[model samples]
Target: MSRRPPDGEAPVVTAIVVAFDSAHALPDCLDALRGEGIATIVVDNASTDDSAALSERRGARVIRNGRNEGYGRANNTGVRAADTEFVLIVNPDVIVQKGAVAALVDAAQRYPDAGFFAPQIVEPSGRVFFQPRSLLAKHLTNPGGKLVLPEGEACAPFFSGACFLMRRSFFLDLGGFDEKIFLFYEDDDLCRRIADTGAALIYVPQARVGHGRGRSSGPKPGLVFKSRWHQAWSRAYVSRKYGLPDPAPSMFAVNALKTLAAGLSFRRSLIERYGGSAAGALAFLRGRSALRQEGLS
Candidate 1:
């Protein structure tokens, strides 16, 4: 049952889900948000599937884009359309658990200085995914650190882009996610900016959500290539933007060699992965636009 706010009180949060070809997982995501009485806006990034229609039928206001606007830009569109004080940015693969939205709102009320509030994300197997580390640690060191679940509300350097609640005014004031980044690392950039402003990125263990990782886009080869390409491009872009060590030079060389080897072996998948990485790095080195023309077919 959907719970309404007290009489004379306005709704506190609106959920924003940016959809590509996400019809498969969108229904459950919308259902979960509706169950919490949260108004949702589905920003359809020119999905060829029935994502927009399904969202509208499920009672979410749908914003249809003419073309794929990538993740950050589409989210910015949704955030701008929302009227609530706080905005819940959720991926189509994430199911916001019962009371999770309420918990995030309560945390926001308690931590007035926080710009972002993230819930504990669990996998289907019940494994908690909570890896919080500084930008330097992420780039300079091995990122596969031990996972220690937070006992309570904890301050994090950065939260996953999968799901989070953020102050609407603060988000807009910061210009939302950097549109220069087509995909990936947008969260890191946002968190860094929030931290620079002396605002907190709080992780509330009381709130939980189930994340079906990488389910937003289907397993098409072109989509996979696009993801890998953007991952490398965005990583290099963020590193350079923040004055971190440039990974492009080394990444390009290593991935180029790997791609050549994979080509010789006729390993199609490896070739795609390594070739995409190499191309992305070279693009970054050449100062090419991050928003490439290639997109999902």
Candidate 2:
């Protein structure tokens, strides 16, 4: 039988934290969720470490996958397992502040038309990126700061995917995140889909999450190459999907070419990273839909 939240009571929320070799960060993340009055599910993406064990130790239900599934698919696994109407999607490195979940619930109650609600995303260093670098850089920073009209919590032009509350029914109706994307641009796709449906995607500053940035990327050099590749590929894919003009490489590309012209004079690290990006761009131009190589979560 389908479960429904009781009337005149706190609405049940299932907090889904996707983990991949995240044992180092799971304790603090799961600890903050404790006593938040929400059931927790740690979706372990076949982590090599003891992420599943740590989550179980923290009293969160664990759904361990046998293979290494990427972000969107893993979240889809947890979302399907959850019975609550509200699902809180957050990264393993994010710490939900006091009243954050409640504030989102309160806003959901207030804004009945909003199917999605995003809270304030603050870095662990207490800084907020208001002015992000590029179109793709904005995907990493704040999404709706410039969308302020009269200055208040309203339907955002877009919202960060780091931590947010979403209506389960509407989310399922939209077919969840596109699994073709291994890592990047899935959140932007979600926000775009919500906006396309004419449903509200509100940004509630009252709620907040402290994100320990860079913790999500396992700090591995190979992962860095994978990230750059997916970043370039996803940007191109999203641009095409939304009927936008083709996304060209950044100004740094000119420098890359200049360095190549000058007898491979650029930093070895820059060349290595840009090499993956160049390959991804070529794949996008060739009309490839999925990543051919595997990437770590």
Q: Could you give the C-alpha RMSD of every candidate to the true structure, in order shown?
A: 2.6, 4.8
**Model 1, backbone clash pairs (residues 3+ apart or across chains), number:** 0
**lDDT by candidate, in order shown:** 0.87, 0.75
- Taking all chains together, each candidate's TM-score versus the true structure is 0.94, 0.84
Which pairs clash in the backbone of model 1?
none
Winner by TM-score? 1
Report the lDDT tens digits of candidate 1 across residue range 1-297: 125688898888989999998999998999999888989999999898899999999999999999988899999999999998999999999999898988998999998978899999998888888764655333323366656777889887878989999989999999999998888889888988887888888999889999998898656656656677888898999998889999999989999999999999999999889988998889889988677544432
Runs with alpha carbons beyond 4 Å of true place in candidate 2? 1-11, 129-151, 248-266, 295-297
The candidate scoring highest on lDDT is 1
Question: C-alpha displacement of 221 in model 2, angstroms?
Answer: 3.1
Evaluate candidate 1 by giving its C-alpha RMSD to the native, one decimal.
2.6
Give Cα distance to truth, residue 57, candidate 2, Å. Answer: 1.1
